[model samples]
Target: MRLSEFSVPDTLAARGALALAEQYQSEAITAHALRSWVWAEAFALVDGITGIDHELLYVAAVLHDIGTVTEFDNHTLSYEHAGGHVAIALAAGAGWESERRERALEVIVRHNWPRVDPAIDAEGYLLEIATGLDISGARPDALPREFVRDVLDAYPRGALAAEFGACVVDQAERKPDTAARRLVDGGVLEKLAANPLEAR
Candidate 1:
């Protein structure tokens, strides 16, 4: 499968999602989100995950962490849930049908899951694994080493480790019941700190 087919979607919602992510998230987070797209697309190409909507993955990648921003943060909701609701609203405004809007929500909400059955939601499963690869460098051999190098060179991780760490830590402090707390208490910081991608 050629990788040329996997790329940022040119749809209205995709553009809006990127714009909103840039407007609301810090630069590190925005780059992290975009890197997640690159990772997801790369994974899809290698794994031959065809026939799905690339636009949905792009939208999910860009806005999956929007709730981490102060503007969208929810005290009672996990960041992914907050981000999913925000994505659903944006999708509706972008003229998506109800099913597509809901699917976008599913992709964003499940991006952090440890596992998502690909038969049910390929985009979610892709995003979950992609974000894992980006954030913690899980399954490093899944993608070509040269491809990973090109992507990191193009996007650069910047201060993602520090920036995202503080954000999640803050989220944990405010919402002890959420996944952020679980990640914090489970030593996700150490994982991020030790992530292979963090190196130049």
Candidate 2:
């Protein structure tokens, strides 16, 4: 799809995603510098996911962290608390339907670690994996082997899921620290260990 097709018109989330992506690409920002950038990259992988409204997922991913800009000191809690307000404002500003707005808000709120429900299964799964991938940075040690295994087992043949996983691995490998590299390398090794029945 054309990038513009994914755009949420006149919304801060949309603008912020683009700006953060550009900043990262230019090396003008550290991974830490662009909290939204990491969120958007993870979101883009969600965009590549199928069996869902890619637009809605993309929009929700972008807006998920809007609360971070204001109350970054406790981002996770802040995001959980403030996500609805930010989502409501942005959705209304963008003229989104109430259903769509609510769905997006739900995704944003549940995007936290150790996700809350399996009912919104796909979105929740994506959010957990995406959040793990983003926080892990170019190399994430935070995600344990069991978590990766659980996610993989749950979505074994999903193309979008595999793509997202691969992106996390690849990005992690590109970091400067040997520790980060080791984490990525080790994570893959651990994944293989956990799922010996599966092919690499």
Candidate 3:
């Protein structure tokens, strides 16, 4: 959450997404618009995620066009490749530990597409969940039953464990949709193409 821990470029990317989100909120962006903004913001945030080298993951999430941007019907493959490219680029930039960068790339590669490694840790799991959540575009009040179903389907076995799962569910149930919306604005998409993650 803290920007101090991230690299300059990472920080800039996050700030750019934030500005876009704010713009969308003010304009009362529609659900589709908000979904786009959310994906961009989520990508920026994922880029700087702590305890995980998220540069590649962020790129994957940002470019995870589920029939939105690219022509590919299988967004899973698209996201994997996009993330892989980002990882390669970031590695070339020499901003992260080589081993960590490799692992990050691996995580992105396995995120949705079928791979030998299906297991994911907390950060990766969270990224997957967040990615699905953003694409689903489930508003607080309008959370389709299918949204929950899909989340459950994706994470059939609760990694949070029973007690933790209960707590997460409880919190989610109590938290208003508006609160989640406030986390990121609805206008993020339009500005994402232009904004920089950090302020120059």
Candidate 4:
């Protein structure tokens, strides 16, 4: 399915999450978050992934990179875990039950790790794939031609590559013992301008 077939969640929690992201993050980050959601939905359609709670997935997608924002940055743990806590707080404020909030937290934290298992946690897996596809140039061939054109037309990669690369590199430099540092050390953001999954 195309991105046009999907709709963002309209709940207060969803709206607040987006608003909070916009309030704290740069334009590039906000755009990347939205694009990640579209990519997740696109992959789910193409790969036949199922049994997802779209609203919860929406929350996870939008807030996945929140730790990159200055306000959420925690020096001790990886940014993934820090952002997961921020998401959990938002979920709690929204009156999410204990179980649902925990699951959402799991999805948020898992996005930082590689090799997500869809069978065990579909939202996390899809979010991980989608974020990787958008930020690291992973699996561009999985997207349909028309779909790629449509998503870029809507979100516009613009300066996201440069912006995101800087964010990752900065995090790695500031927080030495974190996953972002590992990704940087491994050259994940070395090709700054070349990594984003643009339409061919």
RMSD of each: 1.6, 12.4, 16.5, 1.5
Residues 77-134, model 4: lDDT tens digits: 6778888888889989999998998888899888878779999999999999998888
Clashing pairs in 2: 138-172
User: Model 1: which residue pairs collide?
Assistant: none
- By lDDT, the better pick of 2 and 3 is 2
| 198: Cα error in model 4, Å | 4.3
lDDT of 1: 0.87
| C-alpha local distance difference test of each model | 0.87, 0.45, 0.36, 0.84
The count of residue-pair clashes in candidate 1 stands at: 0
1-200 per-residue lDDT for model 1 (tens digits): 23344667788999999999988888888989988988888787777888768888899999999998889998899999999999999999999999999998899888877789888898998899999987877888887777777778777888999988998899999999888888798788898998998975
lDDT of 4 at 181: 82
TM-scores, all models, native as reference: 0.95, 0.44, 0.35, 0.94
Candidate 3 total steric clashes: 5
Q: Which has the better lDDT: candidate 2, or candidate 4?
A: 4
In what order do the candidates fall by lDDT, top score first?
Answer: 1, 4, 2, 3
Q: Give me the candidate number with maximum TM-score.
A: 1
